[model samples]
Target chain A: MKRVEFFVAVLILAVCAGALWLSRPVAAAEPPNTPRAASDSNDGALFTAFVPVLRHPRCMNCHSKGDYPRQGDDSHRHTMDIRRGPAGFGVTAAKCSTCHQDHNLGNVHLPPGAPAWHLPSPSMPMIWEGLTDAQLCQSLKDPKQNQGRNLDQLVEHLTEDKLVAWGWNPGPGRTPVPIPHDEFSAKVKVWQAAGAPCPSR
Target chain B: MIGFSVNGKRVDLDVDPSTPLLWVIREQLSLTGTKYGCGMAQCGACTVHINGEAVRSCVAPVSRAEGKSITTIEGLSPDLSHPLQRAWLEEDVPQCGYCQSGQLMSAAVLLREKPAPTDEDIDEAMTGNICRCGTYPRIRRAIHRAAEMVAKGGAR
Candidate 1:
């Protein structure tokens, strides 16, 4: 009975040793601290960089849910009987191109223009008017709400779309988006690379 | 070069496309009846007909007039014989006469669309055109008179 017990103990010791050896390579292959830990620190700051640009009147003017797009930094209702036609362009005779051209007019107080100048279509107004930073972040990341764009496409649109770029060069007398386009683009990429994490607040 | 007809006259010019149709009509074509009250299109003093649609020419780029027929206030009548024009004179619609051309042009479209326009239709159509002289009441009366003439088949 003593000899049988010794054999059993030896077998158990061998099994334990085999399990440790098998796990050794996996432990070495993994990073010292997961990339998630390092990126968690930066994701919030990276996304925060986008807040000011998104909240600026230039961006918010057409992003609201109102049937008519707002104008000026004051965010007043657009005059001229403009209504968001089935599409974002104004209704009937008050179409956006009726005043706004492909480029800004030479003088101040005139309609600032861009290609496809319009508000978000009524079906998906993509309203950011009253959203908190956290809500904005979540809505932006949600494909269902963001015009069916994934993270990379969202980055491309916010960074490269001509209409979006108009926020930076919003004609004469208008204050532009807070961050420079290049820096904003970089921050967006960083946020994307970090898995597009949402902030708590 | 952009090509379009202004008041039944074919015009093909090499002006910058971004030039406002108001400038093209007033300066280039030498039709000055359409006054420029507000360049921002807020006030409809520069109203004109683009293919029979009343569009504010001050904010409408000439490119928008490309391939379209443009009718300025000058084209409304040869000798001020249009129904709206006669009605304007009959009702003394012009106080300052600055916004009259735009008012007449806008009224013409409204009359065409609604031969017998109520006060509400006139108000809805002519609201964009502003007359600083406070001649709205007179303008409304003139539109009703013009509508009556059209309904009677008295004027083309």
Candidate 2:
């Protein structure tokens, strides 16, 4: 009976040690790229870093809900009465490509341009103009609203998509997104690493 | 060399792809009918047809025209007999005559898309072309007259 009790105690000690080892930081056990689960204390703050980027004129000009895109720092209606057309580009003679080119023109007040310059298609406007930070975060995470992007894709788009990158180098005279591109990209990665948490409000 | 057909003639040029198609058509191809009004494309004076679609050439890169067919005002008709041109003459549409080529080019596509364009269609289609001479009323009248000519098949 004494020997059996001793074996049972040893077994319990072994199990407790295993539990302690498993409770340590997951970084030691997982692959380098595996995203950590959301840390309750940090996720909210991580999402806050993205708010200014989402609201910048450079990002909102094309992401608003409307048949026409706004232009300039003033967010005025585009001159020449341009329409969003069947595609996001303007209709007929007033198409986006009619004026915009693959890159910015050398002069200020000239048409600021980039490749495939257009608004989100009418079917999927992805409007961000009036959304609260919480709502925007939820919308971004929702696959239906986010064009079916998973967290990895969301990170990739925020970090590397050319159109999104345009918010950084938006021509002469245009104010770029408030955050530096690399900083914004790092925040996005960190947020993704924290399971892409959203603010409560 | 970048190759494309302009007004039914195939030509190749060793120009930078970023050069505006307007300069290519004007300086290299020597097809000056497509006038340059606003180099920013705010005005439609540089309108031309790329693969039958009306395009503003002033802002369009030569790279965008690669392997495409370009139609200038000169190609509207070999003998200035396109319906829009005929209507413009009949209705007396030119004032300064500088904006007429671009206006005609834009109108041709409008008519092609809307065989019998209504007043609203005309307003929508021709809105991009600007005429500082205030010939809008006459331009509208000419588009209507051209639509009628098209309906009757009286002129090609």
Which candidate tops TM-score?
A: 2
Clash pairs detected, candidate 1: none
User: How well is each residue in A7-92 modelled by candidate 1, as lDDT tens digits?
Assistant: 99999999999988777642233332333443474446757877899999999988876777898899898765567767777543
- Residue B81 local lDDT, model 2: 91
Give a tens-digit lDDT track for model 2, residues A121-196: 7877788878888899988888787778998897897789887888899888899989888678777776776678
Please provide, for model 1 over B1-156, each residue's C-alpha lDDT reduced to its tens digit, 9 standing for 90 to 100. Answer: 999999999999999988889999989999999999978877888989889888889988899899999998899999999999999999988987999998888888778767888886677567677888999999999989988888899999
Best by DockQ: 2
lDDT of each: 0.82, 0.83
lDDT, candidate 2, equals 0.83
lDDT of 1 at A132: 77
Weakest 10 consecutive residues, lDDT, candidate 1 chain B? B120-129
Error of 1 at B21 (Å): 2.3
lDDT of 2 at B3: 96
Give RMSD to native, each candidate: 10.6, 7.1
